[model samples]
Target: MSYIIMEIKKISSVETYPVRHEVLRKGKPIETCIFKGDDDEQTIHLGLFLDDQLVGIISVFKEQNNLFSETNQFQIRGMAVLEEFQGKGLGTKLVKEAEKHCINLNANVIWFNARENAVPFYEKLDYKIIGDSFLIPEVGIHFVMYKKIH
Candidate 1:
């Protein structure tokens, strides 16, 4: 098997939609991948590339969550890795890179509404589920997961 080098870098929010739609939204409309804070000035989107092709994506927004009293908290959203690249440590790399990015901005915490299936992945990265699972309308079950970055 040939080894492929992966490049992880900061990208524009619009650049994240294709992978997000393909892997996260699936049968849903493409517009479904365009999240609320995608264009926020304080939001940062990270894309993982393999040989110049984008394969994974995640977005971090400088936002406060009521559950966490910290004012320097950020929320992770629109995190998706293409099906073929799902278990190759690409997602872990993306989150780690995002944490570094958050630290540069002086962020103390990073949180997200993680899908049920992804809880284990986040747990491996030391993110804790803050509350019981809840349904997100058409999005199935989810948990509020968070980690301290500072």
Candidate 2:
């Protein structure tokens, strides 16, 4: 593959809506893209800009899961990359950036409820599944996946 310039930086939560809506929420209402802790002070949104276009986005919140014993945990949510950017490794890059930020905040683990179709993607990044898949109402089946980051 030829060289390409990729820019991933901290972005506002609102800036993540479009990408998440397009890639994750599709026919669902726009309000579905607005996560509960999106506007929290400790939440961080990362955007992957390819030639100035926001092709990938990820949001991380400082939330703990009872499944994990770690006191400092971060949950990654609303991670998406445009269809055109798929298979280009952009998703992996976005996740790595999130992990870096979580580490800086002394986060001991990074976890999220991965959509069934996305399980392979997170598994490739070394995340492990903790329990049986569960339904997320309108969102379909999901698995709780996590990776120790400290």
Candidate 3:
């Protein structure tokens, strides 16, 4: 395996729409609704770039509360890896970088509405489930999971 250098950075205005659409369209069939937005929030969006190619991405939203009722935590949104990049540990690296960024922002935890199929992935990272499964329109069944950032 080639050494994959993952660089994380904020998503700029020009990359916003493209990233959103890519996450929605390529991520899953139901992602279109949850990702519906005009990119007008204080969310920190980060893309995983391998040299010059955009291969994976994740976003962290600093918040006091949301439907998940998580306070003093950062929410993970729009996590997706390019099909070709799957299984390269890029997704895990992206989440780790996001968690580090959240800790830097004084956040005590990082959480996400994780799809059922992804529960084990998050579980392996030690993210604890906090609630029963629920579905968001255009998004499939998911659970609110959280992991403390130390």
Q: Pick the candidate with the highest TM-score.
A: 2
Residue 34's lDDT in candidate 2: 94
What C-alpha RMSD separates each model from the true structure? 1.4, 1.7, 3.6
- For residues 1-150, write the lDDT of model 3, one tens digit per residue: 888566878775345445546654655543352453326576777878888677777877765445444457778877888777788788899899998888778887788788888899899899999868999776579888888765
Candidate 2 residue lDDT tens string, 38-140: 9999999999998789999999999989999999999999999999999899999999999989888888999999999999999999999999999999889
**Model 3, poorest ten-residue lDDT window?**
29-38
| Tens-digit lDDT track of model 1 for 20-98 | 8898888998889888978989998999999889999999988899999888999999899999888989999999998
lDDT of 3: 0.74
Model 1, residue 134: distance off in Å is: 1.0
**Candidates 1 and 3, the one with greater TM-score:** 1
Q: lDDT ranking from best to worst?
A: 2, 1, 3
Model 2, position 117: C-alpha lDDT score: 97
lDDT-wise, the better of 1 and 3 is: 1
Q: Show pairs that collide, candidate 2.
A: none
Q: How many clashes (backbone N, Cα, C below 3 Å) per candidate?
A: 0, 0, 1
State each model's CA lDDT, in order.
Answer: 0.91, 0.94, 0.74
What's the distance in Å from true for residue 59, model 1?
0.3
